[model samples]
Target: MPAPNPACASNKTEPSMLADSIDALLPQTQCRKCGFNGCLPYAEAIARGEADIDRCPPGGDAGIAKLAELLGIAAKPLNPAYGIERPRLLAIIDEDACIGCTKCLPPCPTDAILGASKHMHTIIADLCTGCELCIAPCPVACIAMVPAPNLTWTETDADRARLRHLAKQQRLTKLEAEKAERLQRQKQLLSKAKSAKNQD
Candidate 1:
C-alpha cells in the first residue's frame, strides 16, 4: 500500500485524519477478519462511515471499548461475523514438512517469517502478531496456529506490532519503487538501441 498522504497527515484534526489515529490504536494484525485488507484500511472505512468500529476480533471487547471512546460512541459487542475473541496465537512452521515454496512469506504483515525460496522457513515469534495471515498460503499445510506460550496480549505488544507493520510497508514500497525505476531504465536503453539501429 502507498504511504499515507503527507497533506492528510498535516491536518491532524480532520475526520479522516482521526482514522490514522484510530489505526494506530489497532493491533496491526492485518488479518482482514474485519472485512478489509488491514487495520489501516478498516480504520479508514470506519472514519468514512463505511464500517463499524466493532469489527476487529483481535482487538476484542476492550479494543471495541477503546474505539468507542475515541469515536465518542457507545461500545458494542464484537460482530461475530468478523470473528470471535480468543487467546493470542502464533504461527509455528513444521520445518520438516515445509516445502519452502515461500508462499507464507508475503502474507505476513510483520515480516516475521524468515527464510529464502526453496529453503526452510522459520517464524520470528517476537515479531509475529499472530494474524494467521500466513497459514492459508502454505500449500504444504506446514503452518499451524498455536496459542502464544506464557505471553499475554497488551497495548505494548500492539504498539510493537504496529511498528513492525509500518516497517514492512515501507520496505515493500521501497522495493516497488526500485523495481519501477529498473524497468524504466530498461525501457530507455531499449529505445536508445532501437534509434541507433534505425539510423544505421
Candidate 2:
C-alpha cells in the first residue's frame, strides 16, 4: 500500500509519531505476525496511515485498539492473514538425531542456544520468550518448538552482563541530560538575580 500522507490526520500531531510509539510496545520477533518486516517499521506505516492496526496477531485486539486510540483512528477487526497468537514456546534440539550445523545459533534473539560448530547445541528454555525467531534459521529442521521451561531455567553470565551494560548506559544518558538542564536553569536564575540587584 502507498504510504499515508501527512494530511491524513487533521490533528496537530502526525500519525507517524503515534504509530512509532505503538510499534515500541510490540514484540520484535520479526515473525511477520503483523505482515511487516519488524515491529518498529510497521509502527511507522501504521502511524503514517499506510497500514491497518488490526494486522498484528501478536498484539491481538488490545494492541489494535491501543493504536487506534493513539492515532485517533477507529478500532477495526484484526486481519486473519497474520494467524493467531500462541503460547510461548522454545526450540528444542533432539540430541541423538542432530548434526551440529550451528545455523540456529546466529538467529536466536536471546542467545538461548549453547554449543560449538559441528557440535550438539541445547536450548536455554528459560531465556527463550517463545518468539520463534530461531526456527527458520535452522537448516537441519532439528529444532522444534516445545513449551518453554519454567523459572528455574537460567541464562549464562554473558547474557546478564550485556543486559546490565545496556541498561546502565541508558541510565547514564538520562542522568546527563537532567544534569545539563539543571545547570542551564541555574545559570538563568543567577542571571535574573544579578539583573534584579543591578536594578535595586
Candidate 3:
C-alpha cells in the first residue's frame, strides 16, 4: 500500500510532526504486527488517520485506550486482525541447537542477537524487545519465545528501543547507498575496459 501522506493530518501539527507524540506512546518493539514496517510507521499512519489505534497487538487494550484518549475518540477493543494481546514474550536461542548461520541477526530490530558466522548466537535479554522477529529467521529453528514475567516494559525502555531502531535504519540506508555506488563504479570500469579492448 502507498504510504499515507506525511501531511495528511488536519491538526495544527502535520502528521509527520504529530507522529512523535503518537510514537512516544507506542511499545516500540519495531515488530511489524501492526501491518506497518515498524512502530513509528504505524504511529505515522495513526497520526494521518489512516490506521486505527486498536491494530497494535503489543500495545494491548490499554494502549488502545491511551490512543483513544489522545485522539479524543472512544476507546475500542483491540483489533483481532493484528492478533490478540498477550504477555510480553522473550526470544531464547537454544545454544546447543543454534547453527550460527547469522540469518537471525538481521531481523532483530534492536540488534539483540550477538554472534559471528559459524558461532553460537545469543540474545541480550535486556535489549530483546521480545518482538519475536529473530525466531522466524533461525535456520535451525532453535529459537523459542517464552513469557517474560519478570521483565516489565516501560517508557524508558521504549525510548531506548526507538533510538536503536532509528540508528539501525540509518545504518542500513548508508550501507545500501554505498553498495549502489560500488556497483555503479564497477559497471563504469567494465564499460571502460570493453571500450579499450574494442579500440585495440
Candidate whose TM-score is highest: 3
User: Relative to the true structure, how large is the alpha-carbon lDDT of every model?
Assistant: 0.85, 0.65, 0.86
Model 2, stretches more than 4 Å misplaced? Answer: 2-8, 14-16, 149-200
On the 0 to 100 scale, the lDDT of residue 92 in model 3 is 88
User: Worst ten-residue run, lDDT, model 2?
Assistant: 151-160
lDDT of 3 by residue, 75-163 (tens): 88987988989888898899999888999989999888899999999988888898888878777799999987656789888999999
Q: Compute each candidate's TM-score over C-alphas.
A: 0.90, 0.62, 0.92
Give the clashing pairs for model 1. Answer: none
Top candidate by lDDT: 3
Model 3 CA deviation exceeding 4 Å by range: 1-10
On the 0 to 100 scale, the lDDT of residue 82 in model 2 is: 69
Q: Write the per-residue lDDT of candidate 2 for residues 43-145, one digit (tens) a residue.
A: 7776666776777775667667776776677877777776775554567888776678888765555566788888988877655545566678777677788
Cα RMSD for predicted model 1? 5.1
Better of 1 and 2 by TM-score: 1
lDDT for 66 in candidate 2 is: 73
